[model samples]
Target: MGPTREQFIQYAPAALAVAAAAAGPWSAIAAGAAGAGAWAISVSAPALRSLIACGITATGCGIAAHQVLASGMNPLFALGLAVPAGAAALAHHRNLAGELLPALPATTTAAAGAGQSSQAQVITAYWMEFISGPTQTEGRKLIQAGAVLAHLGLDVGDEHMSFTGIITLPQGQQVRVKPADIASVYGIPASQVEMGDPKHYAPNALPVTVHLRKAPEQPQIAAGIPTTVEELWAAHVAIPDGAMPGTALTLTRYDGPLDWEGIATRERKAIGAVNLQDLAGNLDLSSIQIALAPTDKPSQMGVRVMKEHALMHGTMLSDVVDELAMDSRGYVRLGTYIDANAALVPLAQPGSGARHLYLVGGSRSGKSGILEQILLSAHKSRIAVILASPQAGTIAGAGLAAHCGDGLDEAMGALRLAYAVMLDREARYRTPRFPFTDPLIEFILDEAHMLLLASSQYHLEAKAIVEQLTRRSLKRGIGVVLATQTPLAEDLGNSTVIRSQLLIGGGAVFLRCAKGQGSLVGTNAVEGAEGIDLSMIPPQWPGQYAKIADRDMSGLDTEAAARPEDGTFGLGYLLTPGSQAVQFRSLHLDVAPVSLAGSLPPVAVEDCEAWRHREAIMRTPMVDQRGKNLIGSLADLLTKAEQGPPSAAQQGQPAGPQQAQAHPASSAGSAGGDARELLKPRILELLRSGSSPMTAETIARKLGTSVKHVRPRLSELKGRDEVINENTLWRAA
Candidate 1:
């Protein structure tokens, strides 16, 4: 039975004192005095209080015992004396016969031992759980005790009991199993299970069965969707199973009757019926031949029916009649009709597989804009571009500014460097195993002809670079796109290079250039071929173009559809947009007026003097082939004349009667003449150095020249050098 409230109240003072003494020294003294007073009160009613106080006193003793225990005193000593003494006295007064002793259990000691054992187990379990659960496990545990209890079983009152146990098999081996009625007892619904059997609860279900009942065969799939000869030929002839006549049967299930006229119309449009005649003229019969042949197998006929249907509509039979002539090469027309309104069409097809492109047209002929579009497309594809322009700022904002340089020299240098980098990158991947993966880097040099002309003096070098790029760079994924206003044969270099390119341009020269080179072959080239007069090219239309490819018109149509708005077309493909394009302009060089002034100061002339000295040393003459003193003799004569006399050898050398008579006069005259001639240039140089422009007469007078003699000498100087003839006033030659 639990202690009563009155018993608790009667022992409150002692209980408080015990609790206080456990807390602090000051409280211990106060609580002891209070407890003594309570004990004194109990003495007055000792019998009644002792019974009630015994339980409270036991609780108080436990609390006080804790204080002694915490201070390293033996709590068992205090408990053994106080608890047993009280219980013994109480037992002595009580009737023992046929009665259960109402004494307190030895719970404090038992609890301490049990708690210590349990804490030790908990600590061991914590370490084991940490290591086993988190560190050592390779994968998640399939079953956890806590999860099994929560999910698989009914809750019991026991807090520590897990809803887990082991199952012992007949062999006496134990297998851990969480009791899960849902998983262990019940099976999933039949439909929810995927058992490989035809009959339920059949132990000997056959793995596979073949029923004797007749079954309908599946129909062929070639009955629907469009197909062409190349596809059919590939499926039938090239592949083993593709050509089976039995399998070739087409079973087309339609919702209603077929629209024969509509199919015919589509076939006509796809085959370009109206352009059949044009196509016929352009067809390369030597390369490909087109002819009609009847077959019991209409599907085997493939595109032949489509081609005929197209001819019947609007296309002339002559157009594809030649196409039917070819037998070896496989051809497939992807799509038909030009979609001028489709935005994505242009981006779908790039240039025909040609490396070089030639674009020519007059101003306002859409040459530049067309070139820009092609370049923009190339740029978007991250193709390396090298542009050369004499006109600065022309292609500034076109993503090519950084690659562009000042003039032909710089432009060529940049191109050479770009080529070298590409080569180096390729060479770095030259190992037997590894290979280069870079896409072709195309070079678009607008006004390329200008570079050709500007570097004409360096023609051999220019040609070598261009030729190297053209010949070697193709395999390395390098190509050149050149555009010009003129199709000069010299600029483009013989028709060999021009013909190899995908040509785009309008005008007589362009057509003549293409036609002469045999690049223009089809009816388009022939019909408009005559209208390609360069003189008649209109300024308003800039995107007109002529296309050529090794494939049929279908290929051209596909290519046209593949071009992108911001994309670049190959050479000769003119680009047309609906709006005006803004052009970038660069600053021009300013020329300053020439000044006629006093001669430069001596110090300022140092550089000029050095240049003169270098020039003199370079110009100094060496011994002639005959070992004659070429410049030395001239120098010696000047020295002798400066000293005012001829040496003895000079006087005695010519003493024949006529020579002796002529010697004195000739020697005297020659000395003055040599000196005068030597000083004449200096005198003229000084006269021209003055502020005012000088005439030949003024210059001659200043230099003490005879008028008649000065004019001829001045004429000689003017003829031999660049003399400033400003308003007929002479400066210097």
Candidate 2:
């Protein structure tokens, strides 16, 4: 449209003044004054560059006027500089940002907009700016700071008019913009901002469809109802301010699906900006699981939420044990998932070969607790158990094993015997032996890595035997389950191939892995299990746990208060809920773990295929704690067996052994006195090498002997001023 008559009349004065400037010195002075007045009247909030140009042109005119009138210089030459500078101001005036701004509206309109909520104000401001021109400058500052949204048409009504616009998202560009900027710049609050993923993109810029829905008047979370982070954000929860320091989370709903991801990626920091207590109406969030799980609306991708994670409070083995089905079972309940799902691991697959349980953890990773659960579950299921552990469940009670041994020699002997049994079963019955719910024999090494260490003289042989059992013992009636803190390639027997085979039958359990050897998480052990971020879990549960140092006896160690050290236990990742898994806490032993031991008869070297392969293997006898496989005499054991309990005199024996065995060293005439005296040096060497006091049972494991041998020898050593007994721990004097 043509210019309005009023606008033309207003512009005539400036035009006349410009024409007269070429006529005379007075005309030039008038032109400069008129131009400055026009600049003041036309531009509002002009950029510094345009303002400088205007100021310079006006000042240059003043100098020209001063020189012409006072010194009589020619007007054309004097005003030459002023003329070019005025042209530069006109050029900038056409492209000025202030020129795009609208004239101030009526008082009523301003008042109406002022009273509108922040959402309305931002939306209106957006459409107003966008209709004028693109908001970007040569610096790209607008786009980088996410201020370009001001030029993207926005409309906010009730739920119907959410902020919708096509935003520019550059390729490979991370959104470093914060939500608070959105609030401060556009009058939208940080909590109301929600961004959708960028899909299609232009050649120059990626176009992201952004929607800022109206945040609810007051935030609301479904009470006792599970919800996805996406759904909650869709409902207008406090948005995660990732730009803020210390608030970034590795795993987010936008990054990938949370259900399949490991539970180690906690989303607590997702909505961490808001007070969680206010959000959930609760103070304790330790037990609350904020992970993604399937809610009622499975098709819509709802979430699974659990208050007081089933494992955080933790359940006991007895709580989940089915007494009726204990006779022959395949799966052992390690713990409960955060979503209340059972953490089940296969000990023996129905059609496949018997699976070995390869459990690994750093210090305080609850490896021992998991091993104890396997022992108790094996016993309850009436399966034969061959155990080799350093402490050998000394405090927990090793009564549940058919054959119990300790140290490298004992572990080697146990593995060979179990392998022998597996081979014998194959030899006797060439037909495939189906797994579990049948007579199963298991060899459990609590700290098997100790036996497979590269520094150990028996490393090669032990690794060979373990690899053989892991590879060839498939479909046999026996299996192996071992726990260790060191599961490096060197620590694992024969590397990943052998370890992979061992885990083929049953999946592995991974707790807090040791630092500096992150490669362990990439091995067969971690591959078999889903990828989990161990860093998400704290050093320990850091929730409710049994307070330590309950008793401070005169001779007891009181310095050690909380969990052995600053090591993690109980909480860990487990394969669960079908193919996907969740973080769970291994069951706590409310009652004495010894009671979970089984009554399976010993699988001695004499009874295994190992004896058939090398009859000399029988040189290492099964030191059965139950007195059933004694080399010398069974008369006294038989008498005690009928009594159904070990007398106080025989309390040093490992518990839960089937078919009694009289202690050879305790016997009257069978080199009994000589054996007790001979064990003293071994016990002393084990104690002398240690820094802290150990129990008699620990000394026995280091010496490959029973606690009975260790107790008498330790007492004798104390008498000789060679060792000291501090309640349960024995130390060198």
Candidate 3:
């Protein structure tokens, strides 16, 4: 039925009224804003393309404004209407944000080097390569994704979606997806989808990358028709039934807080292994980091590939014995980080004027083992080592240290001797006529917390000596390596200055430690390291070690219950000077520890005069070391002590004249007085000779007898006036 002129004329009055209003002053502004907003929405669908939206919106707004000014409406009226029109447009966009829709994220990637640099249309035998669009196969995959998304109730459009070609590192195309929505596509009830945060995966998701791989084992990962179908609908991912040559896998990173429980339990569903080695020339596997990305509900995890395949394995120091010589860089090569992309850490900082190396770690964290390796290597380089440990460990018993101390009081004598050496060197370096030795001294103080933090009369003296050593000992050819479990300043006798000085020039190694230890190691150590967290280092039980330690005397080497897939022992973070902090494993000397004790003499810290000076001042001066091998390989020293009480034969070296033949006229001792006897006179000789009461360990170390033998004798002596005992510290009466 065609409308006649009479029918059209019946609605003329309403038409005339509408036409008159269209010509009104605000008409152009209203039309312009509406047109511009529509343009913005159409182009910015799926996701807002800011640059294109800005240019398109401004063009539409200007044209509409020009039209109103030309239609006899005053320019002022159009200008006044612009404010409300702009506000309305903004409200429209704010309402449309965060809505999911089908997208061509593939547009962000380009097929680089696919065709010639400059193209001639006639030369197009490889037509697909010449085109900027995805191939037919890719286009079909994109269409499937759009259809699947639509079925899941998302407002997916029939836009030309393409095959998700390949995703490169750092930045890849992103698509908005919800785990529940993905579940719906696979016929799984949306309620079955587990998530900690529903909005997390929905807001911005990286487009799935279908990395083709084949499982060489049974019970393939991502098993089941539903799971395989969902992955296929998403992007034709790998099939799980082994019907196809390559299995499909997508990557998801789990970036969360690092902790044992978290690392072990964090869920990373993506799994597959690719033999990139087969594609040798075409692909470099080293550049490919095979780690997963994030998921819908992210629980902070401390995950690393270290436990199963730790970088440091069966290789021993004996294998690389030449490392004993200082390298061209003046540093000893320790081990590398736990990454295939990792290298090594040095024993000392070169050209930094003998700046110290500070290491912090908890028990069995490899701090002591690392110290043992360092001392041995340093000695091989002709560097003198004065090894002092307040707590007895394998390092103290390692036999050949020029001067070794096992208790706090004995450690102080080593410290005093080191101080004297530093002073002597300082004076000698001043005289132009003096000859300089290339050999430097390394004073390694193991378990330093007791010396620095314990409450005792010598606390102030110990602090003052350490403070001097840290502040002024460098450049004088001496460096102090202080290792402690807790690096906190308050626990270090509230001596923050000492801590600062120790790590000032970026020299610190933090091994697998407890919470907050790495952060407290000092600001300078981890300054430039982008993502270093020492507390994240997984604790390794001895049973987890792939290679068993030869010795287990300190209880540190005792085995503990562990998982079958564990092996990351001696792992931690080390910040090399000028290098960023990263995970590092301290090396191990493969040889039996006791056998290495007789290898070489440590650079002697004590000369004849210094030895006499120590014996005179030190209450429990560790003797048998007056210019000869003092405390020779505690290897056998400890063995003979365990057999029975003390004897002159137990002494490793000859004592000085003053310390020798102590009261040969004593009647209580009926033995073959071979210049010495155990317990009584030796205890009095130590106390009467110096200032400071000493503990049983200190008295044992001084008298060259075990604490079990010295404790009873000290009790017996206290009954008479031979020695006085106060709270376990013994002194002469």
Tell me, by TM-score, which candidate is best: 2
Residue 2's lDDT within candidate 2 is 88
Residue 109 miss distance in model 1 (angstroms): 99
Model 1 poorest 10 in a row by lDDT: 580-589
Candidate 3, residue 91: Cα displacement in angstroms equals 68
Summarize candidate 2's per-residue lDDT along 1-733 as a digit string, tens digits: 9864334323534353344444444554554564465455553434434544544555455555556756777756666655665565555545342233233232211111456554445455553342212443233234243323323444533232345444433443334344454444344444455544323233223232233544345657658553644343323332332211222122222322222222112233321112221323221233124443423321222223342233455676666666312323467677766667766776666566566777767666676777777777777666677787754443154566777766556666666566556545544543574543346677787777776777665566566567666765657667788676655677675466656765565666767766653233345335423334443455644433332223444567656534322334677665432233345678766555665443554333334334443323423332233322221112222233344443445656553333123333333223567666767776777667764555565555445556665677677788899987643546778
Whose lDDT is higher: candidate 1's or candidate 3's? 3
Whole-model lDDT values for every prediction = 0.34, 0.50, 0.48
- Evaluated against the true structure, the overall lDDT of model 1 is 0.34
Model 1, range 539-610, lDDT digits (tens) per residue? 212222222322354444453332221111111212112111111110010111011111321111112221
Winning model by lDDT: 2
In order of appearance, the predictions have TM-scores of: 0.26, 0.42, 0.41
lDDT of 3 at 703: 59
How does candidate 1 fare on TM-score? 0.26
* Per-residue accuracy of model 3 over 1-733 as CA lDDT, tens digit each: 8644322222322232233234444434444453354355454442234322332343344455657777888887657545443443343343332221222122323233334321111111111222212434443322122211110111112231111221111222233244344333333333333332323333222233111111233555665434332243223322233211233232232221110111212234322221211211111222111111122333321223211244536345566666555675667756555543333434444554465887888876767777877776677766777777877654733454667777777877677666656544543443222123545678888877777775654556566667767876676667888888855664466776787777673377877667766453244233433333456555643223332323344567555543223444566666655433555566654564335544566666535333444443333322332222222112222333344324446545445554435533332233433432455777888778745555676666555545666677788888887887654446688
Error of 2 at 353 (Å): 4.7
